[model samples]
Target: MATKRWWVLGCVVLVVAASALAVAQLRKRDFQAICDGAVRGGSLRYAIGDGGIKASDVDELDSELPFGRLSECRASAEDDSTGLTVAVGNLESSSLMSELSGHRDLTGLSGTSAPMGGGWPGVLTVKNKDIAYATVVLKCGRSAPHEGILVNVKQMLVEGEGNFSSDKRKRLKLAQSGAAIASDVSKKWECGSQLGGEVDRAPDDVAVNKPLPLSQATGTCRAMRPLAATAKKWGITRAASTGSDSRAPAQDCVLSNSKGDRVYRLSALYGPLEAGFRKSSSSLFQVSGKAGRKEKNPGWAWAGAKCPDGSDAALFTASSIEHSKENKRLIVGAEFETKMLGAFARDLGGRRGCDDPSLPTG
Candidate 1:
């Protein structure tokens, strides 16, 4: 009797373990499929605050924000520094945590009751000289009111998703640690990663402040920490200015993309920028919001005259430029637009990956 009982017990244990393993494998496959599908669909936005901005919230016909406006305006000709005229539209409450919670519907998501506090309502425009730039007309609690921060790359790309980055992991750790190192191992780990590969090599003759080429400033601009020579080979060439061209500022360096597009232009004083871009003078954007808007006109007399599409490309260019007064500070820029703009024919042909427009922002 004892031997028979032992045999039964062993069989039961094996069966339970096998069931668990099968379930785990199935779950892994499901998640992997979901992630892969999302990426291949070009639905991934490099957003920070919002997992992603949804098509429902961004479509031209849909009402995504509680308050929205659309306007056509021009930059003041007399005061060139008055900058661009902004058309504020589609001001609504968007939740970053909700989008990241894996719940596509804001109503179904947990924490809907949480307050958004003070970010200004989003705006839109179909015309402007510069790409989407936020001007903080209001303040969020005590934060700055005239600056816009690029906090939602995911929303820009995949509209309803989250960005997964190595820096984000470090940030989570720092938040949990209350700004203190829990152990020596943690400090060592961070130091090793920071100084690994490139920083360990030739420490001399590297252009610390040299601006990167704009074309290369897409989502893949790597720093020159590994090899100064390797970095030099990847910069923009035509960026060098002539002595008589005093109007064109001398660049410490220029940013370029794989296609050799000059995505960034450098100013001797402001450092690097997307040529004509001027950061939005807004306060709510200074803390935790991102936007991209712009306008462009290449002299009408040019050959091969394609009416330069200055929308997304301008935003992409603007996002790559950064500036700061402090030497060691990490400067970041965000691009914002009321709606994604491109050739209308391609947009409707499904190349734009049209989303179900039924989702509501409220």
Candidate 2:
């Protein structure tokens, strides 16, 4: 009898161990599924979970959360002019909870706090009579450590709206509905790795003072760091090279003022004759110049104009070289009416070359 009892006890222990192992494996698989989905841009929908709220605008706020190991997903919906934004974050419960409380105080928002069922805490705050926001931090009772979810919702009243008193009931209902949906989503939430796959190519090949390859340089404008003097004078801190083509390897460099409100583009083109050049050059002329004038540089052309905003602009184009027998032609042009256009065009022409060079220094 003792021997039989021992055999039965051992079998029971084995069964229990197997069950525990199976559960663990399932949990791991679930976490991996969330991560995979996130990287594929499915997290936007997944974050909403089973909530009946349909999101018309969904955007990934960030690949990683600001605190701890976390990821965030954002979704928004608009009814007429009113809008609601939902933001979800997956992280540690304790960390999320602390962050939410801290944020509430830091933002100077008057909020009502309450404990939610299932280890969740929520805060609701109203920003004036037209806007309201709420946050809920939830923790699943699963075996995972530091696992938590955060949901934030913000609602904006339509334009010309009065106080919330008129629609208090409706507002309360919406808030309650949002909270319930958030809780449901929290229960299904799982922390995942950084979202999105790496792009196959580098984001930008253009570098200050560094020349790009002909293939990369052609047809694409490279943004370059602006010189200090140029940046200060016209607030032009950023510059780019673009518009290279096959027929003649033509290219253009664009410069933006500090406010990024204005832009200047410079280009050089080659053709067989003046008539051939005109065919290619007319577009540049029409776009930059309504009037023309003789510039200081020999064989160079210049034009000036007043923008609708009362800002001045100018365009400069000139034939760099003329070949009679071969009928080969090279035209250089710069467009900007600011005080700095003359100097800028001269500098650009000096640096014109096929080899990608580092961005010019101030």
Candidate 3:
């Protein structure tokens, strides 16, 4: 009798273990499905497919289980001139929740909170003025030990008529569609724990007087002395001159490499940027300097154009603090192989801190 009882106990344990394993695998697949549907769903395609815009270059979807069974998936798509990317992930840490709460200001965005699927709440914000961008964050549900699902969607207006008022409305519509997609995905996954009430706001903590790093500015352009070697290496033997700018003083210098195939134009603008300027700046390049590409560093925001010589010219802008009371803007334009634009922008950003008094010559 005792031997028969032991055998039966072992069999029961094995059956329970197998059942748990199967459930775990199914959960993982469900998370992946949510991610895939967000990118490939017909509704998303139809939302952005209007007005001669065609979606192409849909990148491969990526999903991963990182840190304590937390699953994440991300995907991106590109249209004629605009880019869209979405990421959905299961939140597993209190620290992550705190971080999300800290960014609740929405900067320049204006929107109201709405209840999402499963009674979870979410905030949607859209920027439609001088710059066009949109963002949405949805709270799915909570799990034991305080885990949840957070969905984020970001879209950038790369190409459109410069008119912001009309463009803003169009961007808002797209943003709403994105939020709907996130809600649907949240429901499908059935994340536990409802995020109660409206979205909360934290106090702003940015230090307006923080000093900017100046290690990159080592050469002088006024006397054309310290940069002499750089100019020589690049085959730019011409003396650096202070170019003309009427609004807020600025300095400009043009140089080219020995082959004359690569040209670099550097400009520095002095004075404070207009109010709310930073808030409206597009976040498309916030992740990677290039839209539709992921990189290791937060690069300068930039745009590119094709030059007459069959080379590509790219322009980038970086903001810095000259001192406690003053702020400066640096703009660099380089003509080089399209693939080298990001590296060139980083190089220019490092060189903007020069101590030359002749910089920004009024």
Candidate 4:
């Protein structure tokens, strides 16, 4: 009798806890909620704060959504001086992201991107000429399938927005505002991930920055410095790089020839982007799912990293344009492509805190 009574009590507790969680999730937010949560500091004039703007004011524009979620969300300031938009879904589902209207892959967007940097695995794109947006991806433990719950939040700020005089000023407010909505959605949605503290400012992106001499390259980009002689044969020397932080979902290093043309490209891809890259990039990516592929015809090599636990591993690739072109004296020698591949694979995996990428013995 005592054993049965304890089991009944345990069941009741679990049921109550589950019910409370469900209720919290059911109280969903509309555009107004996005406004209220955009910047807790009341900095955004049109975002549920000062200037007589409130989230409730924006909710008036949207209907109560089912499950308290919208297929897509957008918030804009009066006079069109400022605007913000967001999309939430599994990172693997590209269809949902496409609905955001000008949002596709990060590479397709024209802007400089750098890590969000406050214990957040994301990037902020400051549009100099065309479209600009900030994107962050968070992984919640097993909330979604094989990968954790991945939510991408992008915030774009126009020049006329509050105090946004230059890209620097705009980035600061953009970080705070975007992080605010991301935090709210992650917690309210109960993705079971740790949300970090406040965000202060945006950091500079090294990858999008101007190319540096091979000798001056730092972090993961330094992996290729030892091969400068080999690259020189193909007229490749300078490198454009991203930060070395493994927490970032995406990272890149592009080797360019003296004339400022791409000679080789190297990258580290994680989560939602892993599949998209393989599909859109050259046919060489197909081998990324396995031990990696090597080819002398195209002068390319790719290596796949092993992730912790049972999750999918990160993918690394090195491809060169001039290496394969017909040039007896200037072309890259056979198997040297793999040398660059191995160098990048090993270096990138070390930086990202993953096991060494898979490579066949020479």
lDDT of each: 0.20, 0.35, 0.32, 0.54
Q: Considering every candidate listed, which one attains the maximal lDDT?
A: 4
Q: TM-score of the candidate numbered 4? A: 0.66
Per-residue error at 194 for model 2, in Å? 28
lDDT of 4 by residue, 1-362 (tens): 99999999999999999987765444322224553343232333323223222222234345222222323355555445555655555545433332221123333213334666676766555444323455556677665332343444444435545332244555655666556666665665555566555667655544345788876776658788888877777677788776676676656676777877556666566654554455443322255355544544554556677766646567776655443345322345546767776788788777666787776444
In model 1, how large is the Cα lDDT of residue 170? 20
Pitting candidate 3 against candidate 4, the one with the higher lDDT is: 4
Q: What's each prediction's clash count?
A: 64, 17, 4, 1
Q: TM-scores of all models? A: 0.20, 0.31, 0.32, 0.66
Q: In terms of TM-score, which candidate is strongest?
A: 4
lDDT of 2 by residue, 244-348 (tens): 222111223444434432233433321111112232322322222332433443223432222222321222232222334574332223332322334433343
Worst 10 residues of 2 by lDDT: 198-207
Candidate 4 local Cα displacement, residue 204, angstroms: 3.3
Q: Which regions in candidate 3 have their CA more than 4 angstroms from the true location?
A: 1-34, 38-40, 51-79, 93-120, 125-146, 161-166, 192-362
Candidate 3 overall Cα lDDT vs. reference? 0.32
User: What is the C-alpha local distance difference test score of candidate 2?
Assistant: 0.35
Query: How much RMSD separates candidate 3 from the native structure?
Result: 22.1
